[model samples]
Every structure is written in structure tokens, then in C-alpha cells.
Target: MNALKGQTLEIVQEEFANKILQIQGVGGFILVRNNGQLLASKTDMTTDPQTLAAMMILSSQDCKTLQSTMGFSRYHYLMVTQEKIGKLY
Candidate 1:
């Protein structure tokens, strides 16, 4: 009895690239909607837009997996933030 989680999912997604090179770090973070859709993400690749699209799919899959594992009744949104990141130097 397999569950149909992402089968009937609708997502309104968006992607963002935070060029915080002046601040620090290289790789950014990813965000998604509650319905397993891309909300926003950051990248610096010429073709990162496309890659991020794919990454969203993977992220959704991973989230769904976790939900199934933990028996989460509903799938919610994913929030990724980098407001307060610390360094160990």
C-alpha cells in the first residue's frame, strides 16, 4: 500500500540568489512552499536557475520521505535562513 504524497501536489515556487559574497560563504540555501513547490533559492552558476529547479524536486522528495518516515499527516513548507551564521576562527 504505497502512499500518493507528491502525486497530486501543486506548488507556486520562486528562486532567489543572494550575492552576499561581501558578507561571507559561497553556497546559499533553498526554500520551498508547503505544497512541495519552490518558494526561493540562491545560486551563482550560469545555469544555476535550471539546477535549482532540479534541486527543488530533490528537496521535495527528501521532505516527503521524511514525512512518510515520521508519519506526518500533512506536508508543510520548508524554511531556510542564514540571518545569524557564526564562524569558528
Candidate 2:
């Protein structure tokens, strides 16, 4: 079971890496579970994957709550753009 889990993780990481590579300006990305666990990530040295994952989870939850308050039935994606940084999900 442990070996299978490891293999699955490797496959996920590889697929994540491939997707990232296909993008043009993506410097890093994190694959996080719905429960805020870091499943797989490929990030630059300056980025902390765990911290980023936690923030993503929190932000997503907050968005959902806000959407509900605004009478929206669903929350689809969030994008934040800054001078030198951008996040899309």
C-alpha cells in the first residue's frame, strides 16, 4: 500500500510539472487537497509550497462564503494580479 501511494504521488507530481511547463509565465504552483493538505507542488526556491497551499485554501473558502452572501449559487475561480505577481485558480 505504501509503495502504491508513493507511485501515485510520483505520477501526480509528474503531471503537475508537465502542466506547469506548458504554461508561459508560471513560475510556481501548488497542488493542494480540498482539506488544505499539500499534495504535490513545483515551486521556485523563493516560494514556500506549504504556506502557499494554506493561503489558497483559506482564500477559496472566503470566496465561497462571499459568493453565498451575494446570492451566487457557485464560485468558480479567483484571480489576483499585482505589479509583479499574479495568481489564478
Candidate 3:
């Protein structure tokens, strides 16, 4: 299938983020490619979206590698929590 590009992709991204933001307690939304490119993000958080995307993508890869080495299946979700900060998913 042909992937969206240019203005078309931007519209879709905005629509998706708007829909998600409509849900209660939804503070942010971000979409990043496997290569660590920031496609779209709508966030009110202090952390930079680009930095967060890169870190999350890299950590996800590491987690997958660790899981495979342990002979485990893929995880449905990953969450990280810090007492001084907060939770990340």
C-alpha cells in the first residue's frame, strides 16, 4: 500500500491526535518511525518530543532484544515509572 506523504500525512496525524486528546486523561500523543524520525506529536509535557521519541524507540529495541534472548514473546506494552518524576507508557 502507498504510504501517506506531505500535506495528506499531516492532516491524518492531526486528526489522529485530536481524536486521542478527546479521551479523558489523555495528555499527549506522538508517532515516530522505526528509524527515530518524529512524524507527529501533540504534547503539553516538559520533555522535548524529539528527545522522548528517540529514547522511547531505542529503549523499545533494547527491550525486544532482551525479550528474544530470554526466549519470550513480544510485549503488548511497556511502562516505566520514577518516584521523583512520574510514569511513562
Candidate 4:
């Protein structure tokens, strides 16, 4: 399992924060690898990064499966939104 550290982590966090700031109504955001490893996050919400990453990975896989079954092309991006929670990948 590769881990982000030191200046690399700092840079990633800063970038994520900056990107989130550009969006409205974004409570928080997390950056994770395809294998569910957390890279960085910016949020005041009390959610666990590891759990969120896992859920994201699962959700992405499910989307791919659904797309294949429907004979659609790959998705360019994915977003999930709720009353208080939203995610983009």
C-alpha cells in the first residue's frame, strides 16, 4: 500500500482544498486512488476517509458494471448527491 507523505501530501491537500473552494455547496471532498487508498481530503464533515474511499471504489465498480450491461460507453465522470452529502469522482 503506497502512502502519501511529507511535502507530497501537503501539496495534494492544498490542491484539493483549492479545487473545493471553487465549487459552491461543497461541504467536503476526498481524493483517493483507484484501489481505495486515501490521498487527501478537505472537509469539516465527520466522515471517515477510509470508509468513504472504499464506498467510492465500490460505487465506481458498480457504475462500470451497469454501463456494460446497458451497452453504453465509459463514463467521463460520476457524481452522487443527497440532501447533505455529495461526492464527485
Candidate 5:
């Protein structure tokens, strides 16, 4: 597949972030590599994007492990929710 870079990547990320922000409860949007590199973000949250990416990478691994142990199909998405901040998808 072709990869996006430079200004093109930024524009795409910005467009995607805009769409995500249109959701009723979304406060932020981030794009991260599987290795925890931050590609783009649109957030007002106090946490650093790099930190969130690293944490999310770890959490996703755990989720995959749980899925395997339970004999579940591969997941298409994951969401984590906190009482105060609501959900992250």
C-alpha cells in the first residue's frame, strides 16, 4: 500500500481528526503507530500523546491475549472507559 508523508499525511490526519471530533462525545483524536510513535493528535487532555500511545499499545496487547484465551475472533476495535472521562475508542 502507498504510504502518506509530509504535508499529505498532515492533511489526512487533520481531516480524520475533524471527522472524529464531530462525534457527540469525542474530545480528542490521535493516530499512533503500533510501536507507540505519535503520528497526529487533536486533544486538549492533559496527558501527553506519546504517553497515551505507549499505554494504548500495551493495553492492546493485553486485550489480544485475553481474546485468544477466551477463543474469541480477532477484534476490530477496542474501547476503554473511565467514569470521569467517558470512553476511548
Candidate 6:
């Protein structure tokens, strides 16, 4: 067996959060309280924590609802498809 070293899940998430959207293709909108309380956002070159946070709220709800319906034993964040996922340019 090989020994693994280095960052934890939190560390990885924080690192990604600290930087702008490093993923190749993704666009998002945050929906809070089942509505639009806040707007979370990220991009290749966008710096806005509040926006990203708002997205967290929306994502949370999506996960919760899915869990309730799907009866998931564990809960995690929700991640729908991003607009930039396709190549139609």
C-alpha cells in the first residue's frame, strides 16, 4: 500500500474557493430560500466572495430536496450542469 500525504477536503475546497473559478467550463446562479435571496457567482477572472456564498445557499437547498426525495443516507452539496459545459462556438 502507498501512503498518501497533503491537503484535506476542507483544504482543497478552501484553495478552490480562494481562487477564481479554475474549472474549464462553468456558469452558475445562487438561489436562496427557494428564491433569489443572494447571488453567488464565479468565473475565470471574477473575484466576489458574497456571490460565491450565495451560490452555496442555493446549492444547499438543491441537495436537501434531492436527499429528501432520493432518501440519501448522506448529504452533500449540489452541483448542476454549468452553462459553459458545451462546445458550440
TM-scores for every predicted model = 0.37, 0.67, 0.79, 0.66, 0.70, 0.36
Q: What is the lDDT of candidate 5?
A: 0.79
lDDT of 1 by residue, 1-89 (tens): 12245442222222113433334654655454545555455544444544556656776688889989998866566544434433211
Clashes in model 1: which pairs? 13-38, 14-38, 16-41
In model 5, where is the ten-residue run with the lowest total lDDT? 1-10
Q: What lDDT tens digits, residue by residue, belong to model 5 across residues 1-89?
A: 12366456667777777888899977788788878888888888777888879878998898889899998888888888868656777
Q: Rate the local accuracy (lDDT) of all candidates.
A: 0.50, 0.73, 0.80, 0.75, 0.79, 0.48
Please identify model 2 stretches exceeding 4 Å from their true place: 1-8, 81-89
Query: Clashes in model 6: which pairs?
Result: 40-51, 41-51
- The per-prediction CA RMSD against the true structure, in angstroms, equals 12.4, 3.6, 3.0, 4.2, 3.1, 9.6
User: Which regions of candidate 6 deviate over 4 angstroms?
Assistant: 1-45, 77-89
Displacement of the residue 75 alpha carbon in candidate 2, Å: 2.9
How do the residues 1-89 of candidate 3 rate in per-residue lDDT, one tens digit apiece?
Answer: 12366557667777777988899987777778889989888877678899989988988898899898998888887787867547777
User: Compared to the true structure, candidate 2 yields what TM-score?
Assistant: 0.67
Residue-level lDDT of model 2, residues 20-52, one tens digit each, is 767997776778888998877776645577887
lDDT of 1: 0.50
Clashing pairs in 2: none
What stretches of model 5 exceed 4 Å from their correct place?
1-7, 76-86
Q: Which residue pairs overlap in candidate 3's backbone?
A: none
lDDT pick, better of 4 and 6? 4
Q: Measured by TM-score, how close is model 5 to the native structure?
A: 0.70
